[model samples]
Target: MDDLIVKTVTKLIIPFIQLYGIFVILHGHLSPGGGFAGGAIIGASFILLTLAFGIEYTKSILSAKVTERVEIGGVIWYIFIGLIGIAISGVFLGNRVAGFPMGTFGSVISGGMISLITIGIGLKVASTMISLFHHIIEED
Candidate 1:
């Protein structure tokens, strides 16, 4: 952790890792990767940071309160998306029925509410993984 090489390598790779994770999340519907996979990658980056640095250092970067809020917010966002379906179409998770504009096929915005749902899923998964890791570290 104190080594210059480790610090340098971690600092360099962390951004790339996060970028890839976001890419995966954003392109989930178009490609094979989805919210879960992308979120795991992002969470792993944080775990990697914790390993390369120390718990204290990682804590400063992602405080417990912030993590909790993010995790809860993700779920709330998902629920809200579903609620939109109910409110609009009288059905849960209604896509076309909810009148969400589905863009051109195979395009980024083509899936109506799918992209937003996936984003919520990705956020929830990433926060959960980080939270679990943090809890485990704390227990040690």
Candidate 2:
């Protein structure tokens, strides 16, 4: 952790790793990876940062309170989106029937609520992972 090389490498690559994670989350509907996979990727990056920089430094960047809020927000957003479907068509997560624009085929916006749902899932998963990691580390 005190190694200059490790800190430098982590600082250099963290952004790229996080960016890739976001890409996976956003393109999940069109590709093989989805919310869970993308979230794991992002979580791993944070874990890597913790390993390189120590828990105190990591906490300064992403406090436990913020992580908790993000986790709760993700679930709430997902439920809210589901409620939208029910309100529109009496079906939870109803896409087409809910009157959401389908957009062009094979496009980012084509999946309607599916993409939104995945985004919520991704955030929830990532925040949960970070929170668990912090708790486990603090227990030591």
Residues 1-140, candidate 2, lDDT per residue (tens digit)?
59999999999999999999999999999999999999999999999999999999999999999999999999999989889999999999789999888889898888788888889999999999999998998876
**Model 1 residue pairs with clashes:** none
Error of 2 at 136 (Å): 0.2
Q: How large an RMSD does model 1 have?
A: 1.0
* lDDT (0 to 1) per candidate: 0.92, 0.93
- Candidate 1 structure quality by residue, lDDT tens digits, 70-134: 99999999999999999999999999999999999998888899999899889889989998998
User: Against the hidden reference, what TM-scores do the models get?
Assistant: 0.96, 0.97
Pairs that collide in candidate 2 are none
Instruction: Report the poorest 10 consecutive residues by lDDT, candidate 2.
Output: 107-116
Model 2 misplacement above 4 A: none
Q: Which model scores highest in TM-score?
A: 2
